[model samples]
Each structure stands twice: as C-alpha cells, then as structure tokens.
Target: MFVLWDADGNEIRDEYPPVDPLDILRNPENAAFNLDTIIGRLKELGGSDIVALHQLAQNHYIVLDASTKDGRHYIVRIARNSVTSSTSARISNIRSYVRIALDFFRINAPDGIGSISSFKSTANARSGEPILGPYILPSGLHTPSNVFESIEEYFRWLISVKKTSTTVGTTKPDLDEAQVTLKKLENLISESVSGYRYDAELLRGVPSHQDFSGHNVFINGEGLITSVIDWEFHMVKPAVLAADYPAWIRYNGTADPRFVDKTSQFSSYWMAGPLDAKRLRQEYDAVVKKEDPEYHRALKAGTFCRMAEEWLLSDVVDIGCRRMKAWLENSLE
Candidate 1:
C-alpha cells in the first residue's frame, strides 16, 4: 500500500513530481534575484494576464494569481533566496531535484540527507532524518552531508559529544552532573533496544514537514490536496523525529496538543495558526487512525523518542536534565 501525505491525500514521489500545480523560484547568483525571473518562468508555464497578488509573508516569497489564455486559474509562489554556489559542478546537480519529497525516499531513490540545493542525485537528504551534527556546527552538506551513514554511528557520536560538552564547561560543576545524566539516558535506550526491540522501529527514515499545519494545506472542493507548500524545512528524518501531522501536535517531542482559535470574520486561512485548528487536529487524527494506523502510533511515541535529543542538546541544564529524567521513566514503562 502507498503511504499517503495526509492519510488519504495524494502520493508525492521524489522521482516523478507533478508540476505547479506548484512552482519554485530560483536565482543562481548568491546575490538576491528579482521578480523578472519569476515572471519569465510564469509565461513559460502558459500563464498570462498575470496578476501579482499582495505579498503574503514578509521576506519569504511573492504569491501570484494568474490565468491561462484558456480560462484556467493558477496560484504561483515565487520564493526568494534559493541556494546556489560558486562551484559549477554543484550547480549542475541541483538543477534537477524533485519539486517535493513527501516521503523518506523509499520509492526507488537513495536516502536524501543533505541541503535541498546541495549537489546530489536528489534533494531529500537533510541529515538522515535525525539531528546529525553537534548543535554548534555551522555548515551543511559536504558532498551531500558529511555525517554518519547509519543509526549506530549517531549513537556513538552523541556519546562522544558528552565529553566535548563537558570540556566546554571546564570549571562548571554542572557539567559533571550533566555527563552522568546523558550516560544514564543513553544506557536506558540501550537496555530498551536490547529487550523490547525499540530501535528496530527506527531503522529507517520517515517524512517530516517543517510547518505541518492547517495553513500549509491547499485542497480543492472535493478535498484532494492541490499542493503542500513550505518544503523549505520539510525533511525525511530518523523515525524518532518523524512528523506526519501538524507540528504543534507533538512539537519538539513535547507531545502536547496545542491550538488557538484565531479565526477572524475574513477567512479561516488568514490567521496566525488558523481558527478552529484544534478541532481540525482531532479530526485529522481520526482520519489517520482509519487510513494510516502505524503513523498514529508514532504520533504518540515520537515525542518521547525525539525529546531525548531536544532536551539534551537544545535546553538548559537545570530544566532539560530534570525533565529528561522524568521523560525516561515514562518511556521505560
């Protein structure tokens, strides 16, 4: 069975991507490009009498609503700051990437684990579906990401980071305590893997959307998805950080349901988080349980699994270590 985007939504393959229906804007020069590139491409797509709608998001992209000569309509997004490089070889490779990933590259493509515009056979590679590097590293893919190739490699890397982080602490006593807590968490996961086959579930990558929410979803009257925008941070990640639903549902592996009804009299789509979003989340889960049950299980488990990295690497020692200890107790259960 084909794994759908939103349970019953259409399949988005990395190999054969359907066109604009979605359109991405690009400039090869590192310096910013203008609307001319977008307008030229729009005409190529057979859209004329182009109408530039008011800007949607600040400093992100310009949205254009246009009509074809044959009386059809189109919604086009001219995104800014597409990645390019001085290297001719790398530019040659990025010219032909999938318009969308919507998957973990399981359908006849290598695992995509690098920058979207990086040199590669595909653009889906963005850190092996997990947090691959130390939090301080200031670089992206080197020949499609200079990171580990397997799950076990990342485990060992984290263990090594525990030492480096402590050294950075030098005089702080808290570093010693943090080392102990990190080791305890690692051992806890190891024991679970040996006895309960937990790691077996995370052996492969899974699809993750950067902004998985009601706002990014575009659908037709019949409820078929026209396109999923915001693939900028969308990725295929290790199953632990996998998110096949709205990001706020299991945000940062916190696993708490979060929603705010900001609907105005204007329209449901024109809000910060969308009006009645929590209701929509509940409805989305019900649909998933029927159409994609396995993902539903991950929906709950991912918070705990994903929180390990987030709590340890991204949080304060005082709160992160204490919260992580409690989290481990529940996860071991």
Candidate 2:
C-alpha cells in the first residue's frame, strides 16, 4: 500500500489487502498505515506526478510510476518492511550485491544486461519510521541474459562445492525419501561422468540472478532490453549452476505461448526458435564444452544436482518438485 502523486500534485492512493484470508486473520494490524511513511517520503523527494501505481503480488511491493516536479519520470519500488534493523539486513546486503553486479554487467556486458538507477533509503519525516526502499529504477522493457557463458563457469564451481560441502544447511524434516532418491541419482551421475574435475578459481564470485525470467525482464522499442527488476534473489553462484537458462524457459510446458513469444523476442541470444528443452540443453552442452572439453559429463551431472537441490530446498510440494523428480529418474535410466 502506498500513495503516488502526479506532476500536478494530484494524489493517487493504492491499498491492496492480502489475497489470503488467513494472512489478514494472522495479522489484523498489518492493514493500517502501511503507506504513510512512503507517501511522506514521496512528497519530500518531489515525486508528484502519478503515471501508474500497482501492487506486485509476488513480493508484495508497491510499484509506483510517477514524475518529479522537473518532469523526470521514475519507477519507485516501496516494500512494506523497514530496512534499518538487523532483522532485515539480508535484504540490504542482497541489494548491495545486485548493485555491484549490475555495475559490472553494464561495463562488461552492456548489450546483455539492463541498467538500474542509484538506490536511496530514508525514513518517514513525520514518524521517523524506516521503509525498505523507495529505490528508483529506470522504467523500460528489457531481456534476460540468455547467453549462458556469462554464468556457466560459476555454476560448475557451485555444483562441485555443493557435492563436497560439509556445512550444507540443515536437512529438511520430510526429505528422507527425497534424500534417498537424490543419493541414487548422485551415484549414477558419479559413474557416468567420470574424470570430471571442478576448478574453484575460474571466474569465482560471479553474480547470478537466480530468479531470472520474463516476469522480471522488459524489452524496449528497439527490441533491446532496457531494464531487469526484482533483485531480491540475486546471488554469487558458480558458473556451472548459474549458467542454466531461466527456469521459465527451460520448463515452459504449461506456460502461455504469448509469454514465450514475448521472452523470445528479446532473448535473441538463446531463443532463436520455439522453446524446446532438448535443443536448449544441447545448446548449453555446446557452451559447456567450449568452456571445458571434458565438461559434457559434468554438465549433465551438474544439471541434475541443481534440480535435486531445488527439490530439496523448496518448502511447498508443487509441480516443480514432481518435474524435477521425473527428470532426475529419467536421466539416470
């Protein structure tokens, strides 16, 4: 929930109640005064022109399209939570990492990645209450970096670490059966992908937007990507694990064709034709081979490892888990 003002200082307020009734019942107090601080800050920032205001359900962030007194348009992302305390430090850290990575990508892969404006945090002038972000990002259409080379090396290193890491997070309580299934799959991969060596030093600490998808990317009039939003899930991952195409493109069996078309239009580097998992995997295989001649076996195994990791870590039982399980079993056979 937040307020937006148009260039003429015409106020527009948006209040979205949680979709789930349980959410309301659980925290009735959550409804009141969510946007006061943000509204005040908007006023201070001289952002008065309201072009658009809407709530994004995926993250519960209010996306406000408004213009300043000087007629400069900006996209303001306002989160419900405050960013000042230790409890929300992870959010700040992730944003910081993303900022650095975006800067790197802008210089290194200008055509591959979109740009973002500087982020600023402030408290409501009246109440002194902190808000997560009034972060301003450029509003424009963009495409994902479908080119796998950018993160392929990083993913391979990540798979090796996960395979050998002793400090893996606590095991899920109901994953006994899943764990057994994964062990079998792992053993099969180990046997099939013999002599696979992982280099930890190749392009270490490369950043990957784990949730890269059409939903977060936008394409402009020139068919070039102008922006990539939603940086909450960005992380530094090994090239091998990070090199995979977006999950949406890889697993689009149930996605809307229109959605696929939109993604393909801007993701020219990878989506040269209709979305085909086999063909995409083949393309990725070629990419892996180019990076390391002996990585064919490792690439297949690493993909399975990634699917297994996703299955194990997901909190909800959904079609994704079923698909991963089916893919893992089929690959082993």
Candidate 3:
C-alpha cells in the first residue's frame, strides 16, 4: 500500500509491522465512525469556535454537525473547496477526487518526491507563469521539475524557491539574507547526520502525514481521539525529516535556549500550554526511555534532523530560516 526507502533512495522492506492500512481499519471502533464516546477520554483539546471557522475557511474541511431523527450524533465533513452552488465547481472537485483516488491506488516504490497529478500551477492564466506540477508546497513554493533527491538538495531548492519562484527571482536584501541563513542551517543539519550511525535512519524514507494538527483531530466529550481528519497532503520522506510533534502538543518548540533541541528536556508529547508542554516533553522521555529505548535513542539523535524538517515545512521560508540559524548556532556548536 505504501513504499519505503533508505538513505540511498533504494526500495526497502516495511519491517515495522508491515505498512498495511487494513490493520488500522480492522479495529472495530475506528471501523465505526461513532464519534460520541472514544474521544471523550481526552481531557483538553478544542476551545475556540471561531478558530474552527477559520479552519473551515482555509481550503480545508467544512464540518457540518448533523443529527438523525433518533438523536444519533454525527459530524459530516467535506472539503471546503468541494462545497459549491454551481454545477461547474462541484464537477471540478469531483474530478479532483477522482485524481486523488487514482493516485492513491497507483502507489509503488517512488524514488523522487511530488504528486503525480498534473494541475495548473496558478489558478489564473493571466499570471503567465509556466504551469507547474503538484510539487508546489502548501506554502506556495514550487519544487523543481526534477524532484528533490535528498534533504540537502531540498534545502537548497527551498531557499531558491522563495527567491526565484516568481517570473523574476527576487534579489531583495532580506530574501538574500534568508537564503544565507538557510544555507548555514542546512549545513548544520548535514553535519549532524554526515557519517553518523543513524544517518541512514535519519534519511530513511517512509509515508508520512503532512499536517497532524489539533483541528483535524476530533474527540468526543471524553478524551479518546475518536477520529483524525484531513489527510489530503501526504508525503514520502525521511523519518527525521518527517519528525514533528503535532500542533496540539506544540509549544514555543523550545522556550529555553539551553537544550539545543536536546532530550535533556525530555517529556511526553501532548498537551496545551508551555508549562504543560515542558513537563510532558520530559515525562515522555522517562517513559520512552524505559518502555521504548530504541525510539528514545532515535529521538535523541534526531534533534537536528527534526528541526531541519520543521524549517522546510514552515509556513514562510524567510522567517523559518532566520529562526533556525539563531537556534542551531548555539545548539550545534
């Protein structure tokens, strides 16, 4: 169903429990979409409704709360872009769904990155930009026609994408500085993994979710994570590169500058505030250390790796690069 690759981009076996989607669906509660109870086990999650609306409007899901005559609770979700009063728009979204389903079935061991779908790079033709592929990220930066070969190559492409994705690449001073900062940070990530024991694992490729955020996750009155929605943008990438603690658990990433993204501040992942984040991040460490020592070690070695992945996936390139350089200079040195 999914492909796996090592640092060298060669096909590998999915040794970890065999990547089968059915194994997940075989679980009865998940098989049934009953959102009423499982999520109720969770203590804290969603708060603001306006935030929910914001999520709805952002080319994401338009969630409809509905109840049957029997008072059975149900939540209906559809792509925001798919909701349409006109026949044309609905037809287009239908076409998009067809493309996505076809792509899903055709998955094999692909070495390069980017979606197989061909779509107009920009919705407007007046822009005169040569049509690009689906490789354009959620941030609007386009990947090269030749897909990114490795993380180092991706870092370079990312810096260039910001500066040059326009018809005329920007030569602005700030963007240039951003490029320089990104380059330095990229070098730090490269150095951290080069010739290291876990370098292969750091660069090993696997199927990963693009946005594992709070909004997409649904819980009932209790705390169980009954459902997780929004899997439209999935990618195949290295493990460390895909490593990010989801948004609900995300804090300032690191409020203190001392750890350099180290496990010294080890705790469980998952919670709301900065204070809780710290304790969980630490508490997670002790538990992982005793329970899953291998994962704990991977977490320890992947500090730089995870940070690099985060930088690439940042909402804006310039801001992400600048902050990355500032943090790593102290941590990596």
The 0-to-1 C-alpha lDDT of every candidate, in the order given, reads 0.40, 0.38, 0.43
Q: What TM-score does candidate 2 get on C-alpha atoms?
A: 0.37
Pitting candidate 1 against candidate 2, the one with the higher lDDT is: 1
In order of appearance, the predictions have TM-scores of 0.44, 0.37, 0.50
> Which pairs clash inside model 1?
112-124, 112-125, 113-125, 113-126, 114-125, 114-126, 129-237, 129-238
Relative to the true structure, candidate 1 reaches a TM of 0.44
Candidate that beats the other on lDDT, 1 or 3, i.e. the better one: 3
Ranking by lDDT: 3, 1, 2
Query: Which structure is stronger by TM-score: 1 or 2?
Result: 1
Model 3 scores a TM of 0.50
lDDT of 1 at 197: 51
- Give me the candidate number with maximum lDDT: 3
In candidate 1 the C-alpha lDDT for residue 65 amounts to: 47
Query: What are the per-residue Cα lDDT tens digits for candidate 3 across 93-161?
Result: 333322332232233324445433443355666333222123545535454576566766766665555
Question: Residue 12 lDDT in model 1?
Answer: 22
Task: Write down the lDDT that model 3 would get.
Answer: 0.43
Best by TM-score: 3
